[model samples]
Target: MAKVSINLATGSIQKEEIIVGIDLGTTNSLVAFINPDKNPQVINDTGKGVLVPSVVHFGPAGEITVGNEAREYLVTDPQNTVFSVKRLLGRSYHDIENYKDFFSYKVIDDDSESLVKIKVGDKFYTPIELSSLILKELKARAEHALKTPVNRAVITVPAYFNDSQRQATRDAGKLAGLDVLRIVNEPTAASLAYGIGLNPEETKTIAVYDLGGGTFDVSILQIQNGIFEVLATNGNTFLGGDDFDSAIVDYWIEKNQLNKADIIADNKLAQKLRLKAEEAKRAFAYQSLVNDKIGDIWCTLDRNTFEQLILGKVQETITCCQNALKDAKIEVGQIDEVIMVGGSTRTALVKKMVAEFFGRPVHDEVNPDEVVALGAAIQADVLAGNRSDILLLDVTPLSLGIETMGGLMDVIIPRNSKVPTKAGRQYTTSIDGQVNMKIAVYQGERDLIKENRKLAEFDLKGIPSMPAGFPKVDINFLLNADGILKIQAIELRSGVKQEVEVKPTYGITDDQVEQMLLDSITHAKDDVSQRMLIEARVEGEQMVKQVEGFLRKNSDFVSIAEIADTTKYIDKLNAALTSGDKDAIHKAIDELNEFTRPFAERLMDQAISHAMKGKSIE
Candidate 1:
């Protein structure tokens, strides 16, 4: 029994290949698909739990494990076990500098601009690689359960994930050997699960409040003519049920008068307490009181106390909901539906507060944990050409970008973005007196241009000579209805402009595109490494030029000793750049910046004093 039909657009019979929907969650991930009966179903074949813990572990001998098997390593092998890799997706060491202590594993901090890497034993793994392991496990599970090769999927992400993060996710999927057909927003997918936007003739506005582990997002969406448009989205990427668990742990720690560091340092005790806190959180949902103990430590919590402990966090989410509504230019009364999605929504307090805020009954009919995956299945069905009632608008199948610093792919138009769209970002020259900027257009998801499909290269010449990072250039990508891309580069300060139009898909077969995507995934790690090295070299050269210029201009203001110390550091940096060690060059740069700080401050003070000499008092 299968829902098979012909796609009139292509005049070909569509085969039911069982494309799936995957909810790649931070805490837990799951897969679902539309069944033969045309109903969305979560696959939990042969008692394999519907929720797969998003955890991975590496052994002493480099053996790999994922999901439930890996969850055990959270306590036993905290350093080798990787959890919440989702948070590290497309993030740099600097992005999570403040939250480094939150993870027990080592997140390498060598470069701030390069993508994060987790060190397990002696091997380095990027977030993209770690996530691919999880996705691969999911893929294996699906193929085993469905008895078919599942190679295509629609994955869900937070609505606010920027272009880089989204591309990183798509690359992860590709690495997992799945063609990610679409990257659907979690809120939008959750809405689809509840059948809010399925009617082609109906129109409605809804609020989707998603609170999951390690993240919270509230998105206000307008569904019209079967198009789900996100009006506004607001929430903290770091605030969610994980915070609630921490609150519970802190409550117990304070009551027990135990040393906090003692627990975090002791991985077994930390994991035990974390598990107990999670149990207590779930128990309080049904029972008024819950008690638990791990050895000498006692953990107890009542519903009232637990609610009070997490009330502030809950209130924060409510405020985000209000802010989302405000940004959408809608009142609470304007929301036709309030849909709640996420395992955290199962908490009575969360549901009650969300209801109280919107002044309406919340939609919790579907399992919050499975809703996103189910909705994703429905979307997959639509993509499979099984549903004519749903309208899939035209979207760019691949991201288009221009080569940037270090030959990195700076995405100008991300994949799946609607057609007839225009987007732009401001960039600056990396070297002083750079008169010509080479813009090489490429199409793909990898971070480096070598892994992507290079379409064309051009030069924007006649730029005004200025100090490094002084000339502001605006780069824009405009995609028209005919599927042609128009890229425009303008130097606002110099009034120099250039434009190019390229048909991104011209003369390229689908098979060639697939090969390009495959190559990107196959070489992602190498490409990223090369990109980092090039970026380090570029940065080192720029720093050298800038320091030399600064010393020449400010020699009279700076002390001879300061100039000598800076010159020594600059020479060291120049030497390190030739060594091809990004870490060493960065270290030299930091040292130089530290040494010049005082001199730069004094110069700024002198300039301000001179400028104020003839100024009237306010």
Candidate 2:
């Protein structure tokens, strides 16, 4: 029998889980949830405030700090602190080469089109890893405030974010141990927070003008029957409130007649001036003029001067708004509402300009910084089936996945995902010189592929031959409103692609699906155990192959005793694989990895030293 929990006071069945809403912004991030009073509220745990700075610091002893605590290290240890990491997500070094100077830390430039990585001390971190740290912090805070273990979430991203960026965000959430239910658009979330489109009869065209700390975007949305559709979006990922603070900094540098080169050279001095400039920008909200000092540096700015200095930057956003409307094929008069989001929109000139352009009063009553997150909470509520007024979304009947190594089902889209959704995950070749991959798709709720119904199978050809794990294959599943699933696989390095379509529910009765789901649940324990054993065997085989290949190619670098020890571990792993014991296989793999890691690092260090000396080792 299924178990249910009842609230003692209300004598009502309580929700089995709470799904929080997260706004993982470039400059700041926050989490929100539906409170017991049936209202969307942002969590403020221990009065640390609603906003968490998206900064990370790595200490010399390998400790890591995130959010407000990490923000303090920006000036003291600029080289080890990472900020504005969202800009690097899914981006190649070439994509941001022009804006490299904007970063205070080291961003590795390997002269390739692959994803960028940030170097902190001796360690390198991908944007996804850094982002996961921030998400983990938000998850901890939400759990503390709600007094519950929060695991699922609906994350909001900019409407302008591309597929790779969206996928990166999903991966980060997964790394942070959150099962992301939906990746909502920032503008849609903002609209929901304002109570728009809650009534089925309401129809409106709205513009969401968002200018946050490190990014800006203007989205034109059409809402009807509780459905929000984005008409057009345009903005620069690198332009936002941070640039406004920069404008003030530049003005102060010019007005004070200070040595520009010297200020730029002094990292601490530069950060202090930037902080003072931010303070002055905030003070301009109520005061006409402000004067401040950071040590020997003088910071003074009048409201008029600050406005003039940033006029061109703000006008650029207006031009983007114009372009968005043009693409949407709507005039300003057609807009029924103008919603302002982002803390930067608190600027007086920004409000005045947006209000005049839309020919409507802007909605700023809701806290601009928390609007996206609040809207996200409302969306989470809708997904939780707590709001009947909102339109119910159609969802997939069963999970869709591809058969991985070991005949295990690797789910790309989980069951009950809302329709018209697209999701993907990356895979790599397990064999050397792999030039093609066979993709077999399946649909069901089981953990093993043999128990699921096969939908279709296809081959992705023309993958460039490379060492195992060198070729990146991205498989995407696009399920439309009509229940048709279109699967596409692409080798990112070679641009080779293949696509196929299948109807997951065609000719399959509701009774069969119900039985399949019931059977999956009934045999869940046994199926999971078998699946784990198969997976462990596959992993052991892969590790054995990789280690053997490494020895064959680089045996000259290692001593005879080291080779003998490595061979012994490989033999033990092979024995475990034949034993059909998952725990034993895992233990062997762990021992092998731990034994090989030291020599691997030594080899890597030697290679780097040789490369730096303009030489290559055979």
Candidate 3:
């Protein structure tokens, strides 16, 4: 067995083994680590390139392939392939309903506020699960290249990602059998790779312009005393390199006099054109024109035309930079350095525009695609105590959470998170027409709230009565430098709100906090087990209530035999919940969901038909 050691002071695992850094991107993902020479290096196992395409494909026999191997299925089996899953992370059906057609695979539209799920064949998967597959591939690559068992990682996400998206990334890491040490911001990581924050005495303000395959963001950061603080972040998640390629495709279509709808309808032709567009985009770096052909289609584009096509998109990024600077309360002259990150930044137009906007030479010495992972590796090194000169900022002493279902502590602000931070998560009521919700705040490292210290409790009243999961309740935790915690709960639909203040450090001694941390680590396995069982039971109960409510409301739509079958599955789930077996509860829940889906979909179809009886299309 591998040796394990824990730091009593921080309650974190000691870094006796290598901890890799991962840049999980929308179009690609890669892993990096601190080499034996103490320099961060991206891992390229065998002859495979440093970048792995962020794609997953399920075979007919249920076998799954990720990365380069899976990229082939985009044209061959688009329905079975999943791409750009990062966009769906922590998102609900309502969040992505507008752009559902952008995806080739089936993204379930359950008309609920629950997290989005992707359907492949007969199996359902959340974005967290799909992302884990990509991470697993990265982990395997790292281990194969290093000739060691890698299990710890620091993953990087966009600076604009919210708390839910970050949490989803952490969960993806866990599911991939890796201990996610930290979720670092992509801009911060890129800055680290550029050696912008290594000096404690030298302070500088920098602008990081990141334009990746499917997203764009500009972040204003200040580095002082070895601390990297993000002053402001702004970006369009839907705008990126892909849009640039699409412009090329559009140009080609207009030139060839081909129908756009026909091209889209032919998946194979669309993929061919998209791939060719990407090739043409890359070719512009060395030449002024790219004249190519795919079968009968003519792919001819000049550098000037390409630039003109994407001029609007590049201008949009510059506008974001302007807004970021305004929000940071800084002028262009105040920016000491400008760093370029993401593969899209390699374009000459992007580089020129960004440099001109900053009124300074931009830093592009490091590979744009690999900078984030390299910087993350450097951060992992620092966390491993390999760098003594770098000092991390002050952080929260313990995890702060609210009591969720089954008395489980749903952490909002995790332990060791940098203070003066804000985080929030959306929750909903368990019962239909729940007008009030009790928000019980707790602080500790345990999974159960009863085992933690209760900070405060209050009720958020006056919520509008609606069906379960209809109300959007947002709970936010804001912790300041003085250790004062402010918890706010708000119902978005009804405008009902409640707020509470608690000094988390008021009564607890430092030694007591240390003891709690130690206990949490010591009982980590058991605590996880208990937490899992409780969560399963809670899910089972919710499923039962929803099924019962559905049957009561739509009795005329469902057959008697269907109701009896659903009741039978519900009874099985109830028994499983009582048995306190997590696996059994999951299995029962899955069976019921599978059985009920067909009829539920039929009911929905019928309801739509009935509602559209007198309606005419505009």
Candidate 4:
């Protein structure tokens, strides 16, 4: 850690810091501290602008200013003042494909793996490290502004950050030497900012559509009394106002017929034009044409041009909204108020779209950009155990499941099921004479296991071998109130158990989860669709094979006619599996399980009777 120095006529050294609430965002950041009455307040630097741009500039002398002071340097030092690096935070290089268009800076490619390295100096830094730099600056800002030691703070992150990304944020806080009280979700915090102030009569279903500098999130919540339950959340971690800026930049750059080579060669022109375009994009939300001058560059940007450039991107947000509604299983008309958060949502086009979609006005009182920070501070207050009445119950955004017989996803905890919810799913051996079964846990909304993010794996090997498919194994998934996942499993027959303790992995695990995956090289291409087909076929094959093996092993135990009926169903499944026809295999599986009903019933009856005998004596 370095000290902030001041030169008074000649030279000086003053060390001080203060605890703060920081919004470590993609484009901007701010430091907030408690006032005399312990109310959270932003530590404004004389001018009274509470919000700080998360950009940083490295001068020839290595000096830095976080907000407006650093902002002026964007046009001056075009190569420095890293903006929107939050887009790269906790994200993989592969995930970047869906988001790279939002950034104006060039992405430095990594040759080794899926890690993304951005070109900064004659150097490159990982997004986590870069994020730490921004976080450290916030720490220093609060410290220098308050003249007290800043040792603790709370930070906000996108709601959808998987396990790895969440960990990265925590790591960033730690690297900066601040005790990150909790990593609260950006939109969730905004909702808290709005909901905590309302009365019991103010019960309403609020949807938060936050489009910040480099991220977009839509959260549907039911705030009754004081209980804030998040029903559903969906968003592209990369969608935001930054993309809108890029759209304007792309339009202007293309209109002038410039290429990467031309822009890189003329750094000042590029920076000047980008800043102008971004300002125009922001201004178009209020006025039709934003006329501005950047150095010698003059431009009058209009709403029509901005709209035309971003119609597709804007539509993508609509698609995200639709999917979020679907995930929540609610209609637009059911929403009470559309609370818009983030600087980008101030756009007239975005407002019109939201109003048209929900037939309601937006909660315009709370400043979109500042609301999250305020909400975060409130949550920090609660986590500090100050606000006892307010308890936040958030859901794990994705479903969690185990890999079944084949590579198919067998979901235990469905999406939006509620926090601290536990689900148990029983599995049977796919093969006869099998003593051990391995459970691979995953999380995601995808239908296939490969498509989902693998959380962890546990193996139960002490089960007794009867024949093939004799043991019953139950997998239990426990998602706590904070949206973190925990899992455990036990073999019913032998009581053999294994519990999976999920670790704090990098990128918040998902990058949608990077480490949860078995191998990037193995399933990156046919991850989802292929896994579904294979799983279906394997299930059918396992069912059919087990039935045949059962009949052969216990020839005289069952009637010939009964065996023949089950055998016919097994034959259908076997043939379908061999032909690689998923539909037929699925149908055959149902039919085969149906034919085994009587024997299954008998087995259940016998077990019940045998267990009741002990209870009678007691």
Steric collisions counted per model? 0, 0, 0, 25
By TM-score, how accurate is candidate 4?
Answer: 0.57
Give the higher-TM-score candidate: 1 or 2: 1
All models: lDDT? 0.85, 0.87, 0.88, 0.67
TM-score of each: 0.82, 0.73, 0.79, 0.57
Scored by Cα lDDT, where does model 3 land? Answer: 0.88
Ranking by lDDT: 3, 2, 1, 4
On residues 1-618, what C-alpha lDDT tens digit does candidate 1 reach at each position? 866655342344546667999999999999998876689998785576999999999988889999988998887778999999999998887999989998989887743365677767655677887998999989988877776778889999988887668877887887787878888989889988988899999899999999998889999999999888899999988898988899999999999999999887887788788878998999876689988788988898899999999999999999999899989999999999998888899999999999999999999999999999999999999888899887877888788988887678877787777788898877888777899999899998777777778888889999999986789899999999999999899999989999999999988888877787666656655665666677768767877887799899889997888888888998899898999776676667666767777777799999999999988997
Q: What C-alpha lDDT does candidate 4 achieve relative to the native structure? A: 0.67
Candidate 2 local lDDT, 325-424, one digit each (tens): 9999999999999999999999999998889888889999999999999999988898888887777789887889899988888788877678998999
The best candidate by TM-score is: 1
Off by over 4 Å in 4: 1-19, 37-39, 46-49, 56-83, 97-124, 197-203, 224-227, 246-265, 284-298, 301-312, 388-497, 500-618
- State the displacement of the C-alpha of residue 315, model 4, in Å, after optimal TM-score superposition: 3.2
Candidate 3 lDDT for residue 435:
91
Error of 1 at 31 (Å): 2.0
Q: Give the poorly placed runs of model 1, Cα more than 4 Å off.
A: 1-14, 45-48, 110-114, 254-266, 405-409, 444-456, 492-495, 509-618
lDDT at residue 139 of model 4 (Cα atoms)? 71
| Candidate 3 runs further than 4 Å off | 1-15, 394-398, 419-429, 432-618
Candidate 2 global TM-score:
0.73
